[model samples]
Target: MSILIFSLILLVGAYAAGLLGSLTGLGGGVVVIPLLTLVFHVDIRYAIGAALLASIANSSGAATAYIKEGITNVRLGMFLEIATTAGAVGGALIAVFTPVNTIAILFGLVLIFSALMTIRKKNEHAEQTGSKWSYVLKLNSTYPTANGEVAYKLKNIGGGFSIMLLAGVLSGLLGIGSGALKVLAMDGAMRIPFKVSTTTSNFMIGVTAAASAVVYLQRGYIDPGIAFPVVLGVLGGAFTGARLLTIMNPRTLRIIFCIAISFVALEMIYNGFNHQF
Candidate 1:
């Protein structure tokens, strides 16, 4: 009975994660991490590990469609993978040695900061200007939008890459899907369009997760009992979210996202300060 109940919870959580992830392009980690940690009372470390696996599942399942549609810049994703993968490895290694309390506090603080950042920004549909590195790397690309195909140039390749490294490390250390930071680095720093940034970020996420997943596996964090239901539910939810994307308004999604992220951030902070392993 206990096992059955847990399975039901896992499915529900994963389903919600996938649905929200697809709708917002934030990926499943944003939803899974918090759900696992706050609702299930799972340890943060294990929660991150499970989240990483779910990320891979989410990316693999969704990226194909984006790629087929030619909205994902495979080349740009490949180039950035060099940095993010390396960073993931480094971050995972650090995770093995870091104290649990420290990890918890850091993770909480970062999530809060990320949430705040999202809330502060107003949605701007204008194309952002690319930086010098973008010109050098020729990271610019185009994608089909409702209006038509829109072309965008990359900006700040170096800055974006540098940030990716940091993002990778955080992903490794914290067990996040790291999609938000990757998007910020590519879209915010590099001035890529949101669609391009999201698709490319999705393309790169699997590699980042894979880089650290092996380490987690070796450390005995990849519990099949937990991972199975979580992955299945998230995948289902993601599919649903993707389908709903066509009908949902972007502004409404953003507002919901802001509220959700902020809530997760606060939960992390409070848990970090008060909870014990």
Candidate 2:
């Protein structure tokens, strides 16, 4: 009975994650990690490990559909993978050695930062003016929008890549999706439009997750019992969220997401400082 109940919980969590992730572009980790740790009382490290696996699942599951819809640019995603994968490896290595409290504090800070970034208005007409790498990589692309297909030129490709590397590292280290940072890099630094930036980021996240997931698995941080339910729930939720994306008011959603992240961040900080297990 206990096992069955736990499994049910996990499935529900995963579905919720999927729904919320698709809507907010935040991904499963945003929802799964906290629930695992706070509600289930799982260790943060193991929770992160499970989150990494679920992230891969969510990304792979969604990418094909997004690509078919022409929202994901395979070329752009592949190009960015180089930086993100390298960062994931580095971050995972660091995670093995870092103290749990320190990790918690950093995670809290990152959540707060993500919330701030999400609330800001996008700067349209931002100049894609300079950068040698931007030209060589042809980071520019167009995507279908409600307004019609729109073209965007690349700007500061190197800067965006640099940020992705950092995002990947954090993804591995914290076991969170890291989509917020990825979106910021592509949207803010590269000046890609919101939709394009999001799909592309989603497309690239699986590679980042894969880079560290191997290590986590080998370290036995992965608990299949935990991962199975979370993934299932998150995936279901994400699919629903994606369907609603067209009709939903994103600003209202962003505000709610920000509030949730802020609360989790504070909890993490408190736990870290208090040395609470």
Candidate 3:
């Protein structure tokens, strides 16, 4: 294919990836990497590098706006960052030596699990009253609502932090923001409010991605030619998706998102077994 045609095709794919990501709160990296490696035939390492860069762009862009809205727990996010950053660096280093097929298999499994989790119904309104760890760490906070500010309590700090470390490692290894895992840690283990957990996860992922991105850059994995268009396309698409969030039915969007992710997961698993990288 001609260079122009390839660039255009990538631009369109990246935009769709970003749109789905923003709407689902999944981040764009998952879609971006698969499209790059599976469809475009880019090397997995280069696809990872591009996905990492795009993830930073997507998360940081949304995070800035979210911070202004005061939904993010900056203190809690920073506290978790210590573990995530360390894990990301470790995972990135490991990725350099890991076999391509192994990475593909792991990526496929993670996607399948994430899709299954996404489709499972869950209550988002439940909140803890208090916890010893929350008290020590001052994890409790309030957010502004239409009615009034609503306060929330935290629990299971140790478990949350441990899960965050694992999330960080996966993020670095797969070149994704791993927002799903972060949300699971905060909402499932820490008992944080769902909205707060989502915003905080977005706030923290950019920094985690940057840490591993440095490692990928030093390893000569990031290609500017592939990354530039991806950054622009995903960023624009995410912005558009965010705007559409208010107008669209989230439940409908979520159902569509789950179906899309399931398809990608199955394809990735099939490709992994076929040793297609």
lDDT of each: 0.79, 0.80, 0.86
Task: Give candidate 2's total backbone clashes.
Answer: 11
Q: Which ten residues in a row have the lowest lDDT in candidate 2?
A: 123-132
For candidate 1, the clash count comes to: 10
lDDT of 1 at 264: 76
Residue runs of model 1 more than 4 Å from their true location after superposition: 116-136, 146-148
For 1-277, candidate 2 gives per-residue lDDT tens digits of 4989988977887687667666666677767777777777778888888888778888888888878879786777888889888899889999989998888888888878877776777655424464667667766667776777766677778788899999989988998769889989988888877777778888888888999888888989888888778777777787778778777678787789878868987998899899865
- In lDDT terms, how accurate is model 1? 0.79
**Span of 10 residues, lowest total lDDT, candidate 3:** 119-128
What's the CA RMSD of model 3 in angstroms? Answer: 1.4
Flag clash pairs in model 1. 14-233, 14-234, 15-233, 18-237, 18-238, 19-237, 19-238, 130-155, 131-155, 131-156
What's the candidate order when arranged by decreasing TM-score?
3, 2, 1
- In model 1, the Cα lDDT at residue 270 comes to 71
Ranking by lDDT: 3, 2, 1
**Number of the candidate with higher lDDT, 2 or 3:** 3
Candidate 1: worst-modelled 10 consecutive residues by lDDT: 117-126
